[model samples]
Target: MPLIKNVIHRFHVKRPLTARERELRLDIRKPAGDAPHYQLSLIRLNSTFVECVDKWYAERGFGAMFGAAAFSAVAFGMWVLVTNIFKHWHPIGLFFLLVFPVLLAVTAYIFLCDAFTYTHYPIRFNRKNRQVYAFRPDGTVLKAPWDRVYWTILGHANPLGWLNVAGHVMDESGKTVLETFALSVNSTSKQGEVKLRNHFEFFRLYMQEGPAVALQRIQPVPLIMLPPIDRQKESWAFGWERITLTLNGSPLLQILAQVFFLPESLFRWIVMRTSKIPQWPQWVEDECRIEPDDPWRREPGYRDEEAIAAMQATAGARRNG
Candidate 1:
């Protein structure tokens, strides 16, 4: 098989080590005369479908809690206004009756969107069949038959299900490797570790022909978000053909539900009502923003203007002394 010219090499990004460092890292040895047996492929293990589902539900809870609080405050304000208008009648009771239903509806919608569908899955290439598979957390496989596959898109980095869900079928075969957001590697918590292990096992069992003993040279792609969360436009990788799955309905629906707040709310109500204890808190303070203060620069990336000024002043004083 002809290798692509743009092969991603780990050494390219990693700092080159001296003889001793190389030995320390991997016991330095001369390259074998023969070419490496299998082509190396990178598989990033983030969160499993189950974890993502849980996280989505947790977020829905927060949203509903926040929304409920806001709505209740507003309703109270309205009640006060109506009381002033009709001092003896107590019209505030009627106001509560009207407003409670609307608040309930909003909360219900949030639950549906958060619970019903799949999002954040790891996509794998099956070299033997030359197809793709979206590995779900439950061990159910979404297989992309060769005939259905469109060309695989290379590099877009939003972890949420944007173009991540669309499956383009091949024009000639009429088959598509259709999968929506199923697995994600974004969360690095304990749950995330379990999900990564699941994917690693899946790839080990399934990816027979690709690469060496273990997948290597994995790097984290920076996270991006679906629209309405950011001013940036929504993104996707479009396959040339329509997706084919045993399951009916557009995978795009899953993408929409996971990315935006309103659709997510509706998705949760439909999918999560009967379920108990869906998911737990996902947002850790450390991950919310990049850290700036550090030994390296007194700021992340060594680029704080104030820190630079302070350092310059200290250096000048030291020189005078």
Candidate 2:
């Protein structure tokens, strides 16, 4: 059976946002003078950390789950190699070959362990304040302030030297870090080595927070998969629906798509047809959903004059407020 597109539930109707609402949305209001209006939907909020984690993992498709399994398998292989080294299981002259394998195995195990631990912990995104707060699965808040966060930001492939990930931050000196890391932005570009230089330069601009210019862009984090056509029409999984979004600026929305395993309408048919894997009943087929025309992936090419003005006005209001 085919999977489907999810429909988004709108949090607020079409209306001018009040000052307080604008603060909460972290979006600027529409400027005057014939500017078009761009609508942004507030997807999910007010959920506990555990709830967010459950939702994130439960909706990922079979491929991601398989990927994790593959990692575990690699870890097991490493364990076997380590055991072989200690037990002298390899041929007497092959000990040197065993050295590399042993190290590789240890590395794989450590990586897999970290992945599991990261997933088990709950990560929460604050839509209003634009901050991510991660908690242990047991609900203990991790100890760290924004300025002192010692987390690693993953790097991505880049071409033409443009940074792929983007966001804004204010440093301790009150200077805003506008553009940081260009390698991520140029990830999809074909410029190759030259683009990496661009990325580094962009990073320099934001690293010092000299004068803020929104540079860190949020890229699509999914392992890329297309949904089956028929499922696109289903309603139960409204999270997959197509919606218009503004892309040109920084701090791209952290979109969480709930790819469907099967539309209820088709699941029955699947169950009746086959059972190849003995434990397949408990399995669901879905992927980490990516929003179409995601700002980080590509430009929307939207040059709406009205919407731009509105956005600028909103930005001005935010700065003044």
Candidate 3:
């Protein structure tokens, strides 16, 4: 479903990033406003690592299961055609017929895989070690030092590239990309690219500087919606939260949507029953372990401005006491 991540997997950086590539690389040392999409992807935030969702727009569709079924049907058709009708066709036709079943089956498997996998892939920005860990779609993880990874605003398809915040991890000697991951940002213009830049800059600054310094100029962070590990913990298989989130957290709109998207909600309920949850390896988890008195502790973006202010006041008072 996500073209960028798939495109990046096949890519290998042959040379060092040049000046033009660095044009969109805003100074992490400098501050900028944020795109709200960044906050939506946040899963966990702390001094050690800030885990956020990857492929930001991947979760909205309810038709992937259907797509898989469709591809399976096509594969079945090809299988029947090859075995019954086209056994004595031209070499090329026979080749296509023979190859198509496998190709379509592979495509169907891909769809089923995506449908049955985790609700979203997670990317962890390790503030403590200055590393980045991205959960790849193929059940692998992308690891790189935040500094060694070349960060840039990759505008795909001119002004049509909705998501553009991408980071490419390069090998030593500053050549050959090992892996890549896109940050959460949607863009349609130069201004939107700037917004995407700001979203990435927030992470860069947070990693280089601190959350306190990095969050200073950004927008109010959105409440994170993490995938539920236990089915019992989910409300309508997490559809209630998502439906509510559809209209900017409006209660009335959410109610209307529940009524409107009842079928989809039910489908999601069934689909989520089999959804996978990503788990980091022990070594990485060990590295990200928080000390008992880690002074860099910060709260997730789960409140509004006034509520955040009140929370800060309470925290300050507790610290003072």
CA RMSD of all predictions: 21.2, 18.5, 7.8
Q: What is candidate 1's lDDT per residue for 187-222, written digit by digit as tens?
A: 324333333333333333324423332223221111
lDDT of 1 at 100: 63
Instruction: Name the better of 1 and 2 by TM-score.
Output: 1
Against the true structure, candidate 1 has what lDDT? Answer: 0.32
> What's the lDDT for residue 74 in model 1?
63
For model 3 the TM-score comes to 0.66
Model 3, 1-321: lDDT tens digits are 444224323333555665655776655455544442354556666678777766543343355445555786877777677687555656666667767877776665545544555555678899878888887766677788776777766655355455467787777765555566777545566656666766776687778877666555453442333553322324574565564464564777667776645665554655555556567777778878877776655444343457567667887999999
Candidates in order have lDDT scores of 0.32, 0.28, 0.61
Report the alpha-carbon TM-score of model 1 versus the true structure. 0.30
Candidate 3 pairs with clashing backbones:
13-177, 162-187
Best first by lDDT, ranked: 3, 1, 2
Alpha carbon lDDT at 11, candidate 2: 17
TM-scores for all candidates: the values are: 0.30, 0.26, 0.66
